[model samples]
Target chain A: GAGVSQSPSNKVTEKGKDVELRCDPISGHTALYWYRQSLGQGLEFLIYFQGNSAPDKSGLPSDRFSAERTGGSVSTLTIQRTQQEDSAVYLCASSANRGRVLHFGNGTRLTVT
Target chain B: AQRVTQPEKLLSVFKGAPVELKCNYSYSGSPELFWYVQYSRQRLQLLLRHISRESIKGFTADLNKGETSFHLKKPFAQEEDSAMYYCALSDTGANSKLTFGKGITLSVRP
Candidate 1:
């Protein structure tokens, strides 16, 4: 793809429901990142995947949040038992390499009602 | 811990006027700073990085290590420049995950 692509641009789920967001990064990109943007808040780092190394999951808010990247290309972010506070935009970005410019996707807006 | 701060949530400026967006950061190690912008209905994109020392769309940001600041400036603001701007920092090491500041909204009025 010419740019990073995210699926299900909008998702509204009831509280306690699980939601999954997907990202397809640009071809040949070696680094990928996930972030959360609450209403009127800054981007919060969630996780980072660099090659085959263990993902940097330091920023995951809780055990309910998890992510996996398959074949070093597509990634998925799963939020379990979502809470109302989880309502936010989930953004995905990919870069050619670590410390390089990041290309972002339109993001998936998750509304936990 | 690396942190970035954008003090103003909203700024208003007339078209053709100069504009400056303030940003401050704290990091123990050498930092790599960057500016990112998001226009309406657009994805977030890089505006500039301290390492490149280049200007995009007439906007420039100079890293002041002593002050721990990297402020974005433009000689003349344009209506098209109205958008949300974010300041971000990353550690100079291999772990380049970025830490972003609360974004500032720029409103360029005609």
Candidate 2:
């Protein structure tokens, strides 16, 4: 892909429902990251994947938030039993390598009603 | 804990005026700082980094370790420079994950 791609640009789900956001990182990129941006807030780091190593999940806000990256290319973020506080933009980014510049996607705006 | 802090939430300046967006961070080890900008309806993009010490689109930032700050500055602001700016910090290691601050909104008015 020319740039990072995120699916379901906008999602409206009821509370307690499950939602999944997908990200397709730039081709051959070795690092991927997930972030959340609430209204009037900064980007919150959720998770990171580098090559084949264990993912850093320290940033996940709660047990309901989880993510998986398959084959180090595509990634999915799943939110179970979503709450009203989950209504925000979920952003995905990728860098050529660690410590390099990040390229971000448009992001998925989830609205928990 | 590694953290970035952007104090001002909304900043409005006339075009051609000098502009500065304040940022501060707290980290125990060496820090890698960057400024990311998001224009209206556009994806967030890298504006500059303290490590590169390079200016992009007339913007520059210098890391002040003593003050624990990395402020973004421009000699003369332009209307095109109006955007949401974020300050980020990376820990010292191969798996350098970024921690971002609450962004500041810069509105360069004509």
Candidate 3:
């Protein structure tokens, strides 16, 4: 891809429903990251993935939030039983080398009603 | 735990005036600091990093480990400089994920 791309730029869903967000990192980039920005938390780290190794899931708010990167190319973040608090701009970024610099996508605006 | 703190939520300055955005961090060991800027309706991009020690768009940031701060300074503020700025830190590791601050919004008035 030319740059980092995220799917479903904007999504509105009813509470308690499930939603999935997609992120397509830059080609040949190995490091990928997911972050959430809400009015309360400001910007919070959700997850981290590097190549094929195990992902750093330390930042996931709960078990309901899970992400997987397939073939080290694309990623999907699934939120089960969505809550209003989960509504925020979900940003995805990737770095070609390491975490030195990151290229960010336009971001997906998730709104839970 | 690693954390970046930008105490000021907002900063206001007139065009052609000197401007400074403060950023402080807390980490046990050495830290690599960076400054990122996001213009209105634009994706976030890196403005400068401490390691490179280079100036971009007349903005420079020095890593002052003594105070654990990386303050971004520009001699003359431009209207285009009005944007959201974030302070981030990363450690020396393969994963090297960034821990970002709450971010500060800079408004430059003409």
Candidate 4:
């Protein structure tokens, strides 16, 4: 079976520019989540979507960060203005639902130069 | 708010020695604990969960509500087990959010 897939694998963006990261979850997985991994901070939950009911954006660091999942499968996370601090590995995961083990993608490393 | 902590940043063990990775969490309600492993150049995946009560890859974790810990343990470690491990806590009773620890890098020697 195909696992979660993320695009580009790596991205380099100039500071103050906007960037979009894409994620394609495994088929039949109802829940999708976005996470970021950085040195010292470990991994932080960014947002979560489950069958398009209503996205949980509580973990978004600021207003500049946003994500949308279309057709309940593919998701994209956008940063309006990138910063050096945002340079980290952006990971996406999917699961049958909450309380289940999440299957994660290899992640897209974004570097804000 | 729930938080997971892995105090040790790195741990080293011999190939035939026992290994224990510490994990602790603080949550208001009953929470579900999980251990996730990430081998080099591999995707992060679940190693085990408290509810399942099953061992995965020779690793096991016992949840202790009194100590507020769910440390992962293995009787004998292999060099392949060397990787970054994270402790996560899910507040299943309330809002569904997974809080993760900082993670610990384990190195196994032959």
Q: Pick the candidate with the highest TM-score.
A: 1
Off by over 4 Å in 4: none
lDDT of 3 at A49: 88
Give the range where candidate 1 chain B is weakest over 10 consecutive residues by summed lDDT: B90-99
Deviation of model 3 at B16, angstroms: 1.0
C-alpha root-mean-square deviation, candidate 3? 1.1
Between prediction 3 and prediction 4, the one with superior lDDT is 4
Clashes of each: 0, 0, 0, 0
Q: Residue A91 lDDT in model 4?
A: 97
> What's the distance in Å from true for residue A42, model 4?
0.9
> Compared with the real two-chain complex, what DockQ does model 2 have?
0.79
TM (B chain), model 2: 0.97
- Tell me how each candidate scores on DockQ against the true complex: 0.78, 0.79, 0.69, 0.71
- Residue-level lDDT for A48 in candidate 2: 92
Q: Please provide, for model 3 over A1-113, each residue's C-alpha lDDT reduced to its tens digit, 9 standing for 90 to 100.
A: 49999999999999999999999999999999998977535568888889855457889999999999999989999999999989999999998877779889989999999
Question: Each prediction's interface RMSD?
Answer: 1.2, 1.3, 1.4, 1.7
* Deviation (Å) of A17 in candidate 1: 0.8
Chain A of candidate 2 scores what in TM-score?
Answer: 0.95
Worst 10 residues of 4 chain B by lDDT: B90-99
